[model samples]
Target: MFFSKLSYTLGLCCLAAGTILQNGQVRTTNYPDIKIDVASYRFRTYDANATEISYKGRWDSKKVSWWSAPGLVFGFTGDTVAITFGDLTTDTTLVGYRIGGMDWSFTNVSAGATHLFVSSATPGVHETWPFNPLPFELRVTNWAYGVQIAQVHVAEGESLVRIPPHQRTIEFIGDSLSAGMYTSFEGLSSFAYGVGAGLGDTEYYVTAYPGICVSDQNCWGNPRGQAHQWFYTSDTSWRASTIWGDAPEPWDFERQETTPDIVVINLGTNDNNSANNVSTATYVDAYTKLIQGIHGKYPKAQVIVMQLWMGFYASGNSYAQNQGYEQELKDIVAYFNSDEYLSAPLVWDGATNTTTKLDAPSEPFVSYFSTRGIMQHNDIGPAWHPTDVGAIKVASHLSQFIKLTFGWELVATGPEIFHETLYWNDEQNY
Candidate 1:
C-alpha cells in the first residue's frame, strides 16, 4: 500500500495547451501562448498527510462529509491525475475537481477505482500548459455519503503543486439552491462556485442541505432538529440524543480554530411548503436566533441574507403565500443593521471594539439583497432551480455585493440578469 516506496515505467499521454480550440470556452487564462508536450505516463502516490496538499472545510483525519465540502487543493504535472478514496460510510458518492478554480468537473467515487479528478482527457484540460503543475482542487459534491481519501496518484516522480492561501474565508449556509442540487451536474454550475471564482481569493466553505428550514419542524423530508442549521452540525446530528439515547455534542465551530469572515444565508423559501408552515413571527424569531448564533461564533463576519427571487419559484404559489413572511425576514436584517442592535447587547454583543475571536464579540455588518430579475419561465432547470444564466446573475450580483461590503478587490462583471441564453441545457441534466 506504500505507493511512494515503489517505482514503475511511464507512458506518453495526449498533450494539449490552454488555448481554446473549437468551442469559445476559455481554458487557462494565465497560459495564453500554448504548445503541447508528452506528459509522464506513470504515477507517484501521495498519502493524505502530504505537506503539498492544502485542505479546507471540516475534515476528520482523511475523511470529510458535508455539503460541497472544500476537500483538497494541490497542483501537479500529470496528464492523468487520479484519486483513490476508501468509502467512509459504504455508500458511493461524488467528488469534484477544477484547475485554476474554473467550474468543477466531477467523477464518481467507486469503491476502489482511481478517479481522475483532472486530466488531459477532459475537454478544457486538453489545452492547458503541461510544463509546470497546474493548480487543482478536489471537492466533495454531495452529502449523501462521506469519503475517505486514501491516496492521490499523479504522474511519475511528481509531488503536488502547492496551493496558495486565500485572502479570506467565506461560509455559505442554505438549502437546495445553496446545496448545489445536482440532478445531473454534481455542483458543477453552482452560484457558489461563481462567487468564489469571482471573488478571486476567497476560501469557500458551504454547509447546505436539501430541504432544511428556518423553523423547528422538518420541511417534509428533512430530519435535522428545530433550527437545525444553527443548533446542530448535520441532518442526522440529532439522532444520537433522540434515537440512541446518547448525549452527543453539537457541531463545534471553535474546533476549526477560526470562523468565516463572511456568512451568506440563502434560506426562507422552504419555510412554507405543502407539508408544514410556520407563523411569520416564528420564522423571523428562528432566523434572528440563527443570526445571533452566527455572531456568537463569528462576530466580525459580514452576514448576507440573500433573497434569491430569480427563477420560476418566485412567482409560484410559495411567493404568493409567503411574500409577507419574506418581507419580515428582510425587516429583521434591517433591524440588525440599525442603531437598535447597537443598544441591545444581549441580542448581539456586536458593538464591542475587539479584533480577535474572543468572549467580547465584535460588531458584525449585516445586509439583505434580493436578486434583480423576472422569473424566466424557460430558464428554470429541473426542480425549479436556476439554470447557469440565472445562477451567473446571482453570482455576479452577490459577488459584487461581497466585494463592496468588505472593501475587498473588485470583481469582474459576469452575465446580466436577462442573459442571452434562457434555454436550459436539458441534455446534461437528468
Candidate 2:
C-alpha cells in the first residue's frame, strides 16, 4: 500500500522531531503562546578586527537553514535572512536555536557581547543531516558585553497564522530625520535600509533618536536631546551612557509590551537652528510641550507630525531669518489644528522641494559691506545630513503619507512608490 504510506510519512517525521525534543528542551509548534526574547543588541566597529554583523529572517525559505556552529554565512536575499560572523578569535558570542511552537528570548542587545540560552532538539532534518549532526542542543551562555540586534524576526503565530491585532505596533520618534541620521551612510541597501527591510518583517518598535531635536536643545551637536529621546533607548548598549544621557522620562511610557498604533513625529529641523530663531512664542511653547509629552505617552497613538525634508533649516533661501523660520513651522501646525489634541489633522504642508540654483560669482568683493548678493543654494548631507537620494525622497514621502492616510501596506509590490533610484548605492562601506 505504497509502502504503507511511506512508512506513515516517516513516522510523522519521527513524531515531529520527537514532539519538538522535550526533557532537554527545544519547543515551537509554530507559535502556541508567544514568548521569544533576545530583547537587546547593537554592534559596530567593522574592521579593526572585523565586526560586520547582520542577521535578518522573517520568512521566505525555499531552503538553506542552519542552527549553531560552522560559524556563519547563511543566506537569503528576498525575504532577507543574512548572517555573517567571521573569525574574530577574541570577541565571540553565539546562540541560536529553534523548534516550532513558541517561547523565544533575546532583549536590548548592542554588540561585541551577548548571551541567551536554552537547548535540545538534536536528531535530523537539517535537510536530513548525517556527518555528525545532532538534532539540536543549545545550553549557551556569555550574557552581556555590547549587544546589538536591531530588530529580529518572527514574533507570534498560529490563529490561522495570526498577525493582526491592529497590525502589530509602531512608534518612531525623530530628529536627525527620525534618527536614521545619514541613514547608515548609504548602506544596508538604503532607503533607510528599505524601511528596515519593510519593517523587518513586522511587529514594529523603533523609538528613534539621531541628533534629536524639536527644541530640547543640541540643535546639531549630536548629543541627542529634544526633551530626552525616546520611543525606545534605555540601553541597547552603544554606550556613552546610552548615546549621551537624558532621555527616559514620560513615565517610561508605562513600560511597553505594545502600546503604539503608529506615532511618527519628525521634529522640526533642529528647531530651525535654535538661538534667536525658535520663536513663534518659543515654537509654540516647545511644540505644545512636545505634544503634551506625546499625549502623555501614547494615549492611543497615531500622532504623525512631519515636515522638513532637505535637512538643516531646509532651504527657503538658506536662512537669513528665512521667512521667520518658515512661520515658526506654521505655528507648530497651527497649534495642532487649534487644539484638537491631535489624533489626526496636522500635516502642515509637508515640505520637501529639494531646491537647487547657484552659479554666478566672478567679481564682487571690493572691501565688502553690502551691495553684492545672489549666492543661494542648499541640499546637504554627511554631517549636515540627508543624502541617500535625500533619504529616499524622505522615505518615499513618508511611504506615500503612510499609504494615503493609513490604508497602510507600504511595498510588498509597488504603487506607493519608493524606488529612490533603487537605493542609490545601498550601503556597504559607503
Candidate 3:
C-alpha cells in the first residue's frame, strides 16, 4: 500500500486566529495566484539538458527510476497555495510540503490538469479568514515518474510571489550510481545518509539511468543509445537530440533555467557489462562524444568523467579478462587530459581506491577531465548498486574533487559532513 510521510511537526493552529486585532481595525488582503515558471527554479544536481521545458506551457522532467528533484524550492505568499500539474500515471508519486513543514503525498492522482492545494489550515476543512501574506517554500521529494509541473498557484484573490533561484549549480549525469538508486530513503536505503546535504546552498540536478550505457545497449534489456538521457525528457524510445523536431509540441531549452557550472558523469559501468561486448576504443569514443555533446551545450561548464564503482561485469561477470574497467576509465581520462593545453594536464591516474580524503587535490583542469580510483564494490546495495554509505563515499570524493578543482571549499567540520562520515564509517562494512 502507498503512504504519505511528514518530516516535521504538524502543530494545530486555529484558522479563525489567522487574523487578530492588534492596533486598529481588521484588514483582509487577497493575493492573486502566482504563476511560477518551473524553469525559474534550478534543477540543482539534475541533468538540465534532458529536461523538456515549454512543453505546452509545462516543465516535464523525464528521468530514470530513483531520481529525485530535491532542490526545487519556491516561495509563495497566501492563505493557501496550490501546486498544479498535468498528467499522472501509475508510475507517478509526488511528495511535497506545506508552510507548517508537513509532507503530503499524491500518488496515482489524476491525468491532465490537476491542482493539489496546501492551506494554512488542516485538510477537509475550509475556513477563510483574514491573514497577512507569509512566504512559504515547497519542494518535490522525488520524480520517478514523468510528471509535468504546469504552474504554482495561490487563491485568485491571494498573491503568490517568486523567490530567486540558487546561485551555484551542478549537474550529475550517469547510471544508477548518480541516480541515488537503492540509496536509503529516510535512513532505510543503504546510502540514505545526506551526501548532497552539505551543499545545501548549491542547487543540484541528477540525470542517471540505471543499467544504462553511453553508447551500447543496456545489459538489462532496456534502451540502447548514447547518454541521450542527458537531453531528453524521459528514458524512452525518443531521442533527446531530436525530440524537438517532428513534434506537435516541442520543449525549448532556450527557455530552461540554470546552466551548470560543473557537470559530473559516471557512466561506462553498464557499457562494460559483459553482455554488451564493447571494446575499450569504442567505449572511449562514445565517452568522448558524451563530453563533447555536454560541452557543446554549455561551453563554460567543467566536466568530470567518473570511474566506475564496481570492478565486476554485468550479471555475475568479472572484469578479469577486459583489463579491468578501472584501467579503461583511467585510459579515457588520460586521453582527455593529454597535451591539448600547453600546461601539464592534471590527470587522475586511478590511484586512490574507494574511500577518498576530503582534502585530496586532482590535477588542475585544462579542459573537461576524468576521475580516477574505482569506487568500492564491497558495500554495494541489495541491487548491487551503490549503497547509501557508498553514495556518500562517492559524494565525498566528488565533494573533494569539486573543492580542489574549482576552489570551492566545503564546510568539512559541519554537522552534515561530520555525521554523514561518522555514521557511514561506523556502519558501512565495505
Candidate 4:
C-alpha cells in the first residue's frame, strides 16, 4: 500500500519544512538531527557507481531495477539520508523515499531492510537543536526492485550534489502496461515514469516486461527463451543468471548517454494472446523486426506504437475487439513509413474499429498510440494493470502525445501541453 508520491521538483528543491510522523517518517523541523551533534555527524559513503550518484534508467550498472533504474537522484548537505540496500523481494519490492521533493516515503525491505532513511531531522527525536546545513534532494524509489546499490550515507559535513541531466529523453519499451505494473507502485507508477515526470525537461527509459512478447515464439509469459521483452538487457527470468550475469544480453544501444527522443512501443498484447496464437505472419514478422530493431538502434527515434490498453492472455483481457490488430498497427507504421518518411495521410477511420491517425509531416517517426478505451475500468489494476490513477491517465495522454508530436513545450508542472485529439468512438471517451 505504499503510494506516497508528491513531486514539485522543477528544479532541485530544499524548501525545508518537514514533519510527517505517525510512522510516515520525514520530520526536520527546520533541520537539527545529525544525531543532534553526534560530533556534527559523519558517514559519507557513496559507491553505487558513484559519480556522485545520478544513474537513470535501463539500469544494469550491476542490477538496479524498476525495469531499469526507475529512480535514484541524490545530493545532500545533510540532515539525514542513508540507503545501503542488498536484499528485499518482499512480495516484489517497494521502497520509495523523498525529501525536498516533498511527501513520498515508503519501504518494504521486508524485515531484512539493508538500510534506508530520508529524515530531514526527526526519526527518533531527542532534539538538542542547532545544525542546519540543508540542501537536501534525496530520492531512491526503484519500485519492482532488483536492489543492489551499495552505499550513500551523507552526513560527514555533507556534500554530493550533482543532479544535472535532463534535456529531453524518453525511451519506454513495454509490457505490463509499459512496466508500471499493477500501479499501486510499480515502475514508480509507470506510464514510463509519468511520461518522464510530465515531460518537464524529460528523462526516461524503461524497457518493460511481465508477460512480454512481441513474438519471438509462441508466447505464454517468458514461455521459451523469449527475447521479445524488447531485445533484452535485463530479465534473465526477472533477474538471475548467477547474480545478474549468465544470460540476457543483446541491448547495448551503443552505451547510452542519451539517444532516445522518443521510442514508446507498447507491443502486441502478447502476440494476440489466446495462448500466444501468434501468427499473422508471426505477428507481422516479430513486429517488423521490432521496428527493425528500433530503426537500427534509434536513428532519430520517435517510434511510438502503443495501442493495447490491457491483455495478459485472457485473465480479463481488455480490447482487441475485432482483432485486426489495429490494422496491424497501421501496417507496421506503413512499413516504417516507406515513402520518404510518410509525410502525413494515414487517416483510416473505418467506422471506429478502434482508431488510427498519423497526420503530420511525421517524418522519420512511425506513429499510432491508441490504448483504445484510453483507460477506464476505474483506470485498471490487478492483472488488468494500470492503476496509479491508471498510470496518471496514461501519463496524461502520453504527455499530450509528446507535446503534440515534437513541438514540445510543457516542462512538467501539471496540465496544459494542449493539442488534444484522441477522441475514441465505441460509444464514448475522448
Candidate 5:
C-alpha cells in the first residue's frame, strides 16, 4: 500500500482560552504530554475497547485498549495529535473530525498501516495545521468495514484530558443516511451535535446501519432485520427477540453513560425496497412499534420521526413504494400528536391500529424535507448515496427544526467538504 498526498487546511492559528478539566482533577499540566488509556473516560463509550497491535510493538496489556467500534468518539482539548490505524485494505476506512462543533474534515486510508497527523495547532510547529486548538470530537463514523486504532500520539508534554460529556444529548436512529454512507457531512448526529454545542453543553449519539430496514422481513431474510437493532449491535447477525435493554449483552441503556434529550428517527429508505415489498400496513405497524419502543425507553425525549429522503431507490422505479413509506411515517406522527398516550397497547405484530389522527403542525418537531423535494443527490459517489453538500443541506433543515422547537441557539454551518469516492471492487468497478 502507498500513502496518498491529499491534504487540506482550514482556518488561522489562534488560541482558545479555557481552564481544563478531566476526571474531577483540576490540576494543571506543564509537561506538554500525557498518555491516555483508550478505555478511560477520555473515550466516549466505556465498553468498545478491542485488543490490537500498538505503535510500540506487540499488543501489550495496556495498549490493547484501542477502540474497535465505529463512532466510538474521543474528545481532545489540545490543538493536534497523531492517530495510529490498523491494517486497512480498502479505501473506505475513514476518520471524521469536527472542530469546535463547526469545521469538519475527513482522513481516508491510502496506506496499509500508518499514523495520520491531525491538528488545528498553530502552523510551523512540527508541520501541523496552523489553526488554534479548540474543543473537538473525532469519529470513525464509516467503519462498517474494518478499521482499528493502536494509540494516539501527542507531544511529550501535553495531557489528553477528558472534557465532560454534553449536558443535552441527541440520538439519531436510522439506516445508511444516518450512517454517513456516502456523505462527507456527519449526518443528523453531527448537525444535532453542532446545534447542541451552541446550547450550553450538548452531544449526540448515532445508531445507523446501511441496508437495514424496519420491515419484519427484508430481502436479507434476517428475522431481526428491523431498525430497532441499533439498540443492539450494528452487527446484522445477532438476532433475538429479547436482545435489547439496560443489560450488557447488547445495548444496556442503563449502562450507557449518556442519554439523549432529543431523539430523531429517519428511516424508511430501505423499507421501501421493491424486492422486499413490505405492505403499507406492515410498514406502518412496524414504524409505530419502533416509535412506541423509543418512547418507552426515553419517555422524556422529544421524539422527531422524519420523512425519508429520495435516494436512488431500487433501479429508480420505487417512487410509489417510497410514497407509501412516507405516508406511514406521517400517520405515525399524526397518531402521537393526537394523544400523549397510546389508545391501545403497541402490538409487535402488524395487527393493532391507534384511532388518533391530528394535523401535524408544520414546525420544528416535524421534518418534511423529503416532501419538499429538498434532498437531491449531489451527483457524486454512487447515485444511491448523498454527497457532502447534500448532507449539509439535510443537516441545515434539521438544525432549523431543532432551533425553532427548543428555542436553542444554532451553531454556524461547517465548511463544505467531500469524502473520496468509495468503490466496491471485484473487477474494479466504480
Candidate 6:
C-alpha cells in the first residue's frame, strides 16, 4: 500500500545559536560536534478524534532516539524523558523525544493512515521512529564522517552497544533500476535498509547513476556529458577503461572508500541501444575487462552482473531482443569465473520487473510486489537513486544471499526474521 500524507513529531528543546540540545536541556560545548534533530506532525484522519498515544519501555535505558524538522537538521539525544500523546475525548497527536533511553511506546495512533518520521545522526546511532509496518515516509541523514550506531528495533533488554554494525557492505552500481528510478515513498520502504536489517550483518549502498551506460564511449559527449555526471562527485570519478583508456586521475575513488564487500554492476542496458550496438562479443570483452579493472582495485570484492527489469525497451516490446544481450553479459561473468585471478563469483539471482509499472493500479501484480510495493526505484534523493523502500528490497535480497552464502548467523528478532521470509517469497516470484 502507498501512503499520501504522513507526519512525525519529536519534542526537543533547541539551543541558542551553535549550542547543543541534550538531556532535555540546552547546553554549549567547547568543540564543534554533530547532533541530531527531530520533528513530527499529526495528520487528520477519520479516526483522528479518538487516537491515543503512549510510551512503554524501561526509563533511563541507553538507546538511540531520532529527530527531524524543517531544513535537513537531525539529531539524537540520550536522557530520561516522558512521551505523551492523545486527546482525552478524541484522538490528537502527541510527540516527544528522549535523550538516551528506550522504555517508551505510543498507543492508539489512528489506523489506516501513513505517518512520516525523519531523523539524523552525528556520531551515534541514527534512526527514524514508527518503523514497524511503516505507514508513512522515512528520511534519514548521516552528517558525521565517522560511522554511528543506528538500529530499527532493539531487543527487550539489549543495549545499543551490543548490536554490531553490519559486517558485509554491498554496493549497487548501475542506471535508474539499480538507482531506483520513478519510485514512491512506499517503494522506498523496500530499500536497502530493510535488506540490511534482515541479514542482520550486512549494509547496502546504492551508487547507481541514472541513464549512465556501462561504457563512457557510448555516452553523449561534450555538452550533454551523458548520465555519467550523476556518478562522479567533485572528489570521485568513474571511468571504464573500455571507454577512457586508463582510469581518470585526480578524482579519488580511494577516498570514496564507500567500497563494498560485494559490488553489483547493473549497467549496459543503455549501452545496448542503436548507436552503441557494438557486437555482443565486443560488449562482453569490454565488460569483462571492466570487471577485471574493478578487481584490480578491490581484489576481494564480489561482482554481480545484473539484467534489465522491464523498461530497457519500449512498453510494447516483449524484451526478447534484450534477453540475448543479457545472456552475453552472463557469458562475460563465466569468462571471469574461468580465470584463476578473479576469486569472486558474479551474482545474478535477483532480477525482476521494474518497480515503476508495478506501482500502477493497472498492474494488478501483487505476487512479486516488493514489501514496500515497488522494488527497485527511488522516490526522492538524487535524480535516480533508490528511494528508501527500493533500497530496502535490494539490501534485503543481497543480505539474505550473503548470509546463506557466507554462513552468517541471523541476529534480528523473530518478527524481523519473518519479514525477511516474506520478502524472500516475493523475490522468488520475480
Candidate 2, residues 257-312: lDDT per residue as tens digits? 34666666555555555432454465556555555455545544555655444323
| lDDT scores of the candidates, listed in order | 0.56, 0.34, 0.44, 0.54, 0.45, 0.33
Q: lDDT of candidate 5?
A: 0.45
Cand. 2 TM to true fold: 0.26
**Candidate 2 displacement at residue 322 in angstroms:** 31
Q: Mind giving the per-residue lDDT tens digits that candidate 3 earns over 227-275? A: 4445544443222223333331222345546676787776776676666
Q: Which of 2 and 3 is the better model by lDDT?
A: 3
Model 4 RMSD vs true structure: 20.5
- In terms of lDDT, model 4 sits at 0.54
Q: Which ten residues in a row have the lowest lDDT in candidate 1?
A: 5-14
The true-versus-predicted C-alpha distance at residue 15 of model 5, in Å, is 36
User: Compared with the true structure, what per-residue lDDT tens digits does model 6 show for residues 157-181?
Assistant: 3212212224566655554454333
Per-residue CA lDDT of model 1 for 1-430, tens digit only, reads 0001011010000011212211223433232111112232367888877777776665554344445455777877656567766655223454556665345454445554456555666544545553245777766655444566677778787567776667687887776666555322324346775676567656777666556676656664554423544444434432223422333335666665246888888776667553455666777876776777677677678888876442343454444211325578678888777765644533322122122323443464788866645335554554456666656666777887777777777443442222122465658656
lDDT of 3: 0.44
After superposition of all CA atoms, the RMSD between model 3 and the true structure is 14.7
* Among all candidates shown, the one with the greatest lDDT: 1
Over 4 Å off, model 6: 1-165, 186-197, 218-259, 275-282, 311-324, 340-399, 408-430
lDDT string for model 4 (58-169, tens) is: 5565645436336667556656676656553322244555443244445444322334365555442223233123223322233234655666677667677766667778
- Could you say which candidate leads in TM-score? 1
TM-score per candidate: 0.70, 0.26, 0.61, 0.33, 0.60, 0.42
- Which of candidates 1 and 5 is the stronger one according to lDDT? 1
Candidates, ranked, TM-score: 1, 3, 5, 6, 4, 2
> Candidate 1 local accuracy as lDDT?
0.56
